[model samples]
Target: MIFAAILAGGVGNRMGEVDKPKQFLTLGDKPILIQTVEKFYLNSRIDEVIVLCHKYWLNHTKDLIEDYIPNAENIVVVEGGELRNDTIMNAVKYIEDNHELSEDDIIITHDSVRPFVTHRIIMENIEKTQEVGACDTVIPATDTIVVCHDGNIISDIPNRNYMYQGQTPQSFKILKLKECFNKLSDEDKRSLSDAAKIFVLNGEEVAIVKGEVFNIKITYPYDLKVANTIIDDAKLNISDAETGEYKVNLYDFGEE
Candidate 1:
């Protein structure tokens, strides 16, 4: 089975003075989290979707269900935890408690703020996870990367060719990930960031699939502005195509 878990548990601390969480903010016509969910919801490769939303936003998520993914028996909403990994574990526990899953079953974990994840990314993750026990979506780093401590001096600069910026839809085989989590020490559990890291710290090899640059996580106010611009541009392009405003003139090249 191919399952998707979207983490929407953040409090939007960096988004400053917002009435709602960042995930609930509007990008186009729908909430950011709803847009993220719709990617998996519309994917033919996904069998089910689980949304781990903030505890305070449960009712709002339910309301979204009425408008967006209405009567979606395959979709579920559960209260998220204070920490990100806790939210993922909650979804894992939910699956274990409710249904039986195998090692071959893949669970794709994504961020709710990344509303631009495409179907191509989702399908690639599904196929890659089936080949390897775990996989992560990433893009080749275009900028120089530096390792620094205390926000002062750069300690090291890794080769750019070997570096990648990790994105979401980090997928793992059900039982394999469960086993990795079970083996985590107290220190590992406390410091771990995402499921992909789980495989890394455990000395398990994870495959990486190419990700798009537009699949950016909305972390700050600047990101929100960029998201709106991208969405508006996309809408304008579509409108231009539909209205035949985007046309080619052969007369520009010759007198034909």
Candidate 2:
């Protein structure tokens, strides 16, 4: 069984005075969370999608899915945890309680705000995780990466060739992820920036899947504007063969 864990646990502090979480904010015609869910929902390879939403918005998340997606039987909404990793564990707990949890089962964790994730990326994440034990999607860094240990000054400048900006659909074999996570000390667990680091800290290899430049995460007011532009450009560039209607190209890896 394969699961896609859509993390919608954020409170949107960085997004500035928003009525709701950034995931619930509109991007183009649909809410950002729905758009992201629809990507995994449309994929035939994905068995189920688990949305870990903030507890305050759990019902709203369910309502959004019910209204936006037809026959959403495979999608489930559960209350998210206090932390990102804890939220992932909540999804794991859901799978273990409701279905057969096996070592071979794969869980592909993605940002609920990253609606531009492509089919090629999703497929590659599953394939690579199956081959290697874990995988993280990333794109080559276009700018010089400056490492500043203190906010006051730049500590080091890393080689651009070696630097890559990490993106999601960070995937892993279900049992393997759980095993690695259990080994972490409580302090280490609290300091984790993302799940892939859990494997890295444990001396585990994580394969990388090439990500699209347009796979942007909508975190702030500026990002929402950029997301809208991306959607409009995709519509202008692509047209449906059958309907002769302009549509956003959400599946393909290439630029629209």
Candidate 3:
């Protein structure tokens, strides 16, 4: 089974002075988290989706599902942990405790705020995970990377050709990731910021699948603005077929 885990536990501290988490913020006509869920829900290859959300917003998350996603039963909403990695582990524990996950089964972890994830990217994650034990989505870095040890001075400048900006739907085989998780000490687990790093810390090879520039994570205020622009542009390109279908449905009467 291929499962999708969306981590929405963060309070969006970087986004600053928000009443709600960044995932709950509006994107296009729907909530940002719902838009992210829709990508996985619409994908033919995904078997199930579990959203790990903040405790205070879990009820709101459920309400969003009731409103937006028609097949809401396919999604599972659960309380998330305080930390990002802890939220991921919560999903892993749920899967282990409830489901019969196999070594061949894949689990893809994504950010709930990354609403622009494509079906192709999701499929690529699954494909890469099948070949290797784990895979991380990444785009080639276009900017010069300055390694700074202090607040003011740059210690080193790395080659841009070697740097890749990581993105999500970072995927891994269920059993393999579980084994890696088991090897981690409590201190090691707390330090983890990325799911793919679990494999790296375990001395395993994590494969990379090419990701697009548009697969940006909506973290700060600037990111949200960029996402809104993307959404507006996409809305402008809505096909005539869809508009025609809407018109056809609009005129339909109730069954006699």
Could you estimate the TM-score for every candidate? Answer: 0.92, 0.93, 0.90
The residue pairs in collision within model 1 are none
Of the pair 1 and 2, which is ahead by TM-score?
A: 2
State each model's CA lDDT, in order.
0.86, 0.91, 0.85
Tens digits of per-residue lDDT for model 3, 174-255: 8888889889998898889898889999999999988878888999999999999888755543443266643322111110
- What is candidate 2's lDDT per residue for 31-95, written digit by digit as tens? 99999999999999999999998889999999999999967899999988999999999998998
Pick by TM-score: 1 or 3, better one? 1
Tell me the alpha-carbon RMSD of every candidate. Answer: 5.4, 2.6, 6.2
Best lDDT among the predictions, by candidate number: 2
The best-first sequence of candidates by TM-score reads: 2, 1, 3
Expressed as tens digits, the lDDT of each residue in 13-129 for candidate 1 is 999899999999998888998888988988878888999988888989879876887888888999888788888888888888888887788889999999888777888898899
Model 1 / residue 136 / CA error / Å: 0.8
